[model samples]
Target chain A: MIRPANIPRLLLTPAILTTVVTLGVCLVVLLVLSFGRQNYLDIELGLSAHNFELALTKPLILKLMGKSALIATGVTALSLILAYPIAYLIAFDIHKNKLLWLILFTLPCWISYLLRILSWKLILGYQGVVNSSLMGLGLVDQPIDALLYNSNSVVIALTHAWAPFAILPIYVSLEKIDRALMKASGDLGDPPYRTFLRVVLPLSLPGVSAAFVLIFIPTFGDYVTPHLLGGPTGFMVGNFIAMQFGASNNWPLGAAVALVSMLTATLLVCLFIAGSKRAVRAIG
Target chain B: MKNGLERWLVEELECGRIDRRRLLKMMGAAGVGMAATTWSASALAENNLTILSWSGYDIPEMAPAYFDAHPAPDFTLMGSDEEGFQKVHAGFRPDLGHHTSFIVGKYRDAGLLKPIDRSRLTHIDDFFPELEQIVTTDGKLWEAPLSWGNSSVIYRRDQVEVTDSSWGLLWDERYKGRIASRDSLEGLLIVGGLYTGAADPWEMTDAELEKAKDALIAQKPLLRFYWSSQTDLEQAFANGEIVAAYGWNASVAMLRKQGIDMALMKCKEGIVTWTDGLVMMSGGSASDDLAYEFINAYMSPEVGAFLINSYGYGSGNAKAYESVTDDRLAELGITDPDVVISTSKFQREISAETRQRYQAVFDEVKLS
Candidate 1:
């Protein structure tokens, strides 16, 4: 097996080269398009960052970015809180038919994304199941309104959508922990709880960090769930950035805002990477 | 392992040779993929008029009836106005589009739409003169009116007190927990402006916008929920959880038929109504004849009835109302939509800066 390391590298070269070329082409195109003036009447090439300057001043764009950041942070924190315990159980307690538990966790994610979000609309609408159930139970004299729209609805919808993303990474990271470490801790003076707090918790930071990054990026860019659930007030940064490219017809600003969002996401990823680096060093 | 000479050559290439080979294959495969996609896409894109519309615009139930009728245009519901236009710009062309009255000029300026022939539309004359005036730009018709409805306070009379002046009631703290609003930027701002006595709601400057924003943001704690869907909003009203909110006539009419005590009235400073119209797409592969046929199909009274019944909206086809049973017509808000529609004004298309201020101020209002 150790005969030659280049053997695997040689075999993987075609796939690796293909991916690099494909990504290279996309980045080159984005670079070219970034400078072109958007004349809906005609497409052409040019040099410009006038789009960037004007885009920054738009109030709506700024507001949306704020919303996006807020929503992403909230969704990540909420998802981690919900997914952590489930992931911990699967990684430690469930040994037999573990694959079945993985499938069960993943099954809901396999269902249509839009379908799941829209289901909340039905459940929370004026004639929704929640209100109907409440009425049937005679909890109130009249139907309590204001249950669906605004920030509350947005959080509930995003948290539901983000759970699977938060769970899988954590489970993987925890699963990869050495079994001997836990057994050794048990053989030594420490009990199961202390071993988990001291070993399992510290070791699983990489997965938790990975989970946050995964949930954060998509939710930050997600405008649909917030729009349908958040209504106008709950509109996020993604929705705002979308408008610049959309009805607003201000592409430079869209790009700038997109870049800003990208930078924010990059920042988060870098922080996670640095944190993981530190975690690894500390663990060693 | 096969051959030492071949292995030496393979390593000598440093994969640049393979890189070139894959490049050629990818280019060829990509070309083939494009050709295959076009082969299939052309088949799919043909007769497939990717319609830019509202969520309920293309009811799946009516696809068969549409395909049977003077067929061509396929209506695809869009999530929002901004998203629909983005798709149109992004190579997904539609034969025609539906938009609020405000943006028709902007579409024309962007060269995204074609000027329409008023004569070809059978219902052009049937349209309220006020609406007709709005659709015309410097004597050239851009969009044909599709539907127009007034925004009114929709409350179930069974659960809440009905009033002639409803604008004050939306702000009335008595019904605080039970009340709801449409949760629109411009629409909610309009309410806030009126509440503060703005002469024209849309004309608010920055300071005024902030004022309106503050008013709306303050009202948030009072609302059960702000909503976007007419169907869902009606469902809310039907269940009596939503004592009232900004509702179009058609939805209120439909709710009334369900024996819900729904009523619509002109609140002080009066009601704001919108006119939705059809814009023909320009420079698409669509033949002139196909476009004309599609327009004619929409002109049909039968299709008009379908829109009115299911959507709770009106069509411009003058005779479309005749297809509705007299009882149904009166029940569905089409009997004389002209009255409310005739009095209301169209939403004006503003510049991007103004819109930003509008949205910012609108955002500020809801946050307040």
Candidate 2:
């Protein structure tokens, strides 16, 4: 009864089942819930689009969405800029103990994410490490209150929290680059900077795009960092979504906000990938 | 007072109901604990009693008589009454649970509670009559009042200059960037209503709601941050990061204990009062006798004294005041329960629709 042709299909059964059960089922539930309405502590199941209408049209929600996108864009750009150099060093410059260096570079990822974010609070608080050191050095007469509890702090904390994610993909892509291409560019009388611009950077666009999608998607929906560090002006769309479920006690509205946010992120990420692919083709 | 959100998140993570990877992926999704214990045939037959309560009240000190008589009941700590209601609504049955006064009506309407049998409670007459009246609806006692307190401005006396003790201190132009307010909808909106002189802070009309929203928007720039954690507020006070904040009695007591010159202002525009207590859950598998014994023990003066002394909350039992000294009672800001009750404005229950509107207004102010 067991044929070789059926072996591959049987082997794929668990993965397909897992995806359907875990991701597909939950998404369907979320979509259904978004169409429902809240009746006190209970949700009245219906096929109404009232929640979606409100989520899309509310000015407050729109403002928060714009703010979240801005913050996420900042975090992504910062992460790529900070990650690329270190990734480059590990991929091209370092030859001995490269694995050890990679491990050392990503060691911060071993800590709990909550602890890592909290540590940033201690470093950036009013009387934090930076301020205390500056005051001790007689750099200023008063502590710099601007260092914490702002949009910049949120960006800083998110950039640090997501650095390893950006670095690993970039490292892999950089490592995969054929060294012969760079040598060929140099043999054609191109300078080192020109060779890097022509041969190395274009090849790394795949990893750059991967890192962009990875960082932007999560940071766009991040409420914890903004809640902890983003003072009043730093509140994001994620916080608004969370309020619906908590103090607002409107799960359907929360679900609508979440779905809307997800769809927007998906569209933006698709556009980014397409744009980057075209650029890579043009450069090649 | 409700526990901070961070503690709730940590509890969810520890319970294996939520994993860290999923938490990061969701990017701050509210944790709803849906993993109720699956009782085996033998486990169900044993019929263990489960009590859901606030984090600190789950301890044996709160109900010594019941704990001494029975084997320790299964305890689950709630971060907020909403979360507890959600758990029970999702079918996580517990024999008894704690809830605040404002939510009792919702619980009653949802058919999640059973009216108390007043005759079975030995300490029924010892409770403050006013509090008893608060917990009663339609001639039936729905919850046993456990503790009561006020939410008002707690300021560092030495650091700030105050000409008058009023809610206006929160919006004072002089203390801009040195003030913090609560991050909750009810907490901020009620304060906004009181400051704007709304006829009824809880039942504000559309015009009153907009006034409150405008007042809150004007005050937003003055706030250092909207604090959700008592510990964080206290730390900020200690470090002189904030001179004044909207806070609870426990924060005042803790900061004073740390030798900070902290003072709980007697607001000219009445303080926000709240009471929380124990409620028996309907369809609880535990025996009626055990549930009655647990409620009776919590209502006893011994437990009440412990609650007042340790947590800086006013006990529901008037007789519990006899055990505490006049000085300690004064320090806790409840020297006379009758006077405090007469002077303060109790938080009233709002319908779901009204609450949604209030939340919308609050969100608009925060976003603006």
Candidate 3:
């Protein structure tokens, strides 16, 4: 038997030690770097808020952040709607081979994300599968130019990439709900739709919120999806941050951008959690 | 090629399974020891030279003689000059880096380079006069001039009708949403600056920068997408998604080999002429002597011939011309050196401030 004091120390050792050494120390270094001046290969180490000033006041950066947030929110919402029905079927309708359906649904996640995005580019290109078939069938004179390389394509690719994540959590929540509640509602003469709205949805709020966060945070900082599919219009704040590290060679500016974007994401997530908890309370 | 087997033998000897004499006898039976000894006159010849270069520059065919003479060097291929610059600036130095001429001024100024001793490079004098000038900054040689090419509008001839071969073809309303441009800051700005009639595409004034920005913004809606890789542009052109785009000669040659009817436009406005060369970083993994050996091997006529035969890029060594046929030269668009040189405008070194401003303007245009 372990003492309670020793138990706390044992739990804290691995998690806290690793977190402090890896993230905490790196954050300190990044904080220092973000305030210094980068003069080509030489860093002056003079404390300055110039990087923040440059990054924050740029209208382009502001616009990219707003666009990124909006797209992330859109992806999360779409993933939820698309994933809900699949989760519902797996939880309630599917009796035999539920694991097989779940496995098949999440199978695309096994492939590399880059390869997946590239496949989307191929399938949606002007001379891609859909366009070639349509043109072959005499549906149109020329290849459809709007199939890929736009904001819509970015959202589509992101939604596809994150749908599996959305499905699993909602499925778990639905699986946990008691069948007795549904019977009780039916016994009380409540319609199936009303029972679903009042009982099923309320019980599944936690999973929906989990799915929302799982999709939103990653999509918000996604550089690859936008870069491959979004074209110029799809460029987000992450691309801006990447630019600072790459072509700019200004680590300070890149770190500043990262820190600011992280704070914004944190704030958004906090608000989302609080609002969702309230929504759950109201629904209950 | 003997480097791998020799390393295994050395490891075997170190493991005490075989004595040095026995190891040598086993290697003699395999006929590898004599080859290794004959290749390196000194046993202390650098074990490995790390070469950081663009994709095509690091191939075996490009440096066959060097591999034969010394141990095979490790190659880290980067996609862009900016990537190479960042890597070197961040203190990851390789024996030699293949960087474009435009970055030399900035990188040299930043103290990222070591001045090459031209005396060690036997083939330095054999380089073209234009290339010779590119490597020399303030009479101090900093880079080994290797290959040259142009960045121009490569169009699908079967899809689009060309009235005038000009940079304005990109801005033409007919090819709107079907044309592509490079997703690069300096290259696009140079094109835009030239289109807007700036005195110099590089080193644009504040007014010229604004004009360039407006010009790029106007052309953005017309673009299918800004391509960052030659493969992306090639795929786009191959599929007939984009009718025209600014691309390098290598991509044009690559697509043509695949039966894609691609043609590079001889724009009335000058094209972006660039030369890529090997610059030795100050803090390299290999010794200075070993680095120079690789550099000299790279500058030799054999490597030059390989580059021309394989990639269609003009070799820096003028002797490389003697190896290439007249028809191949014409096809590669360098039949007349004087005409090509006079018609093209080389990308010059821009200050970091100007580069940042150009990048900002480009980002704004791209996002807007």
- Identify the leading candidate in terms of DockQ: 3
Lowest summed lDDT over 10 consecutive residues: which window, candidate 2 chain B? B33-42
- Tens-digit lDDT track for model 1 on B162-185? 554757677777777677787555
Worst 10 residues of 3 chain B by lDDT: B12-21
By DockQ: ranked, best first:
3, 2, 1
Interface Cα RMSD in Å, per prediction = 5.2, 2.2, 1.9
Off by over 4 Å in 3: A1-8, A44-47, A276-284, B1-45
- Give every candidate's TM-score on chain A: 0.81, 0.93, 0.90
- Backbone clash total for model 1 is 15
Clashing pairs in 3: none
Best by lDDT: 2
Query: Ranking by TM-score, best first?
Result: 2, 3, 1
Clashes of 3: 0
Stretches of model 1 off by over 4 angstroms after superposition = A1-95, A119-161, A164-180, A183-188, A231-233, A269-284, B1-69, B79-83, B118-128, B162-164, B177-196, B202-210, B223-226, B293-342, B346-368
lDDT of each: 0.68, 0.83, 0.81
Q: Candidate 1 on A1-284: residue-level lDDT in tens? A: 54586889888889989987897675566556556666543445678865555446656566666667777888888999999999999998998998788778777688787998888878876667888899999886555446676777888888887787778899999999998998898898787787877778778888988888888888888888876777546777776666555555555545656766777777876776687667666654
